[model samples]
Target: MDRMFRVLGFFTLAIGLMAFAGDLTEMALLFFLQTAFFVILGYMKFTERIYILLFWAYMFVTFTGFSYWTIFQMGLPL
Candidate 1:
């Protein structure tokens, strides 16, 4: 499971880099946040601290949602 998260983290990092190269700042930021979450999950030494994952998930979702909302509000078609 740890290996899985590590792989996902690398994948997300690649995605973030691509987004950055494309100048898609919102997506790049979102993917970067996801990468951080996955990396943290991978390094966790105990399952008892699952709340950390929950916090990261909440952050990823909330931040991404708000990013989209702000973009929509600004009428940007990104």
Candidate 2:
């Protein structure tokens, strides 16, 4: 379990750096990867129900925010 978390963390950090590099493709990919990583991590820890719920909530918000940001960048309406 610890190993899994470590791997997820590593990927999350790597994706985060790539996202920060200002490439839209990389940023989108990173957001997806990080979101998946968090979901998996949350599921693996069965004892932490609250954490899982929170992580899923965060994922939902992140996805929505990204979608909105993309639409706005494309000059679309809300």
Candidate 3:
């Protein structure tokens, strides 16, 4: 459902914000939350094309962020 996915997205965003002040555990949690949010959007019913596009966009952003975080954690340059 659209409403369900929206709620989940909000929840994940909140968790991601909270994770900003924590350690690896929080970061990992945030990563999973973001992934789930996008995946849910990708599969939700109604307006499938738009939701799919948005899902890919979110995936790109999340993947880039995750890659940057991993690189930073490894003390590597961007």
| Best prediction by TM-score | 1
Ordered list by TM-score, greatest first? 1, 2, 3
lDDT of each: 0.83, 0.66, 0.66
Q: Candidate 1 clash total?
A: 0
Which 10 consecutive positions of candidate 2 have the poorest summed lDDT? 1-10
**Global lDDT for candidate 3?**
0.66
* Residue 52, model 3, lDDT: 59
> On residues 42-64, what C-alpha lDDT tens digit does candidate 2 reach at each position?
45655556655655796798899
- TM-scores, all candidates, are 0.60, 0.47, 0.45
Error of 1 at 67 (Å): 15
- Pick the winner on lDDT between candidates 1 and 2: 1
Candidate ranking (lDDT, best to worst): 1, 3, 2
Candidate 1 local Cα displacement, residue 50, angstroms:
6.7
**Model 3 misses residue 54 by how many Å?**
0.2
- Regions of model 1 farther than 4 Å from truth: 47-78
Clashing residue pairs in all predictions, respectively, total: 0, 0, 0
> Candidate 1 residues 1-78, lDDT tens each?
566677888999999999999999999998999899889978885464564575577679889988998887667764
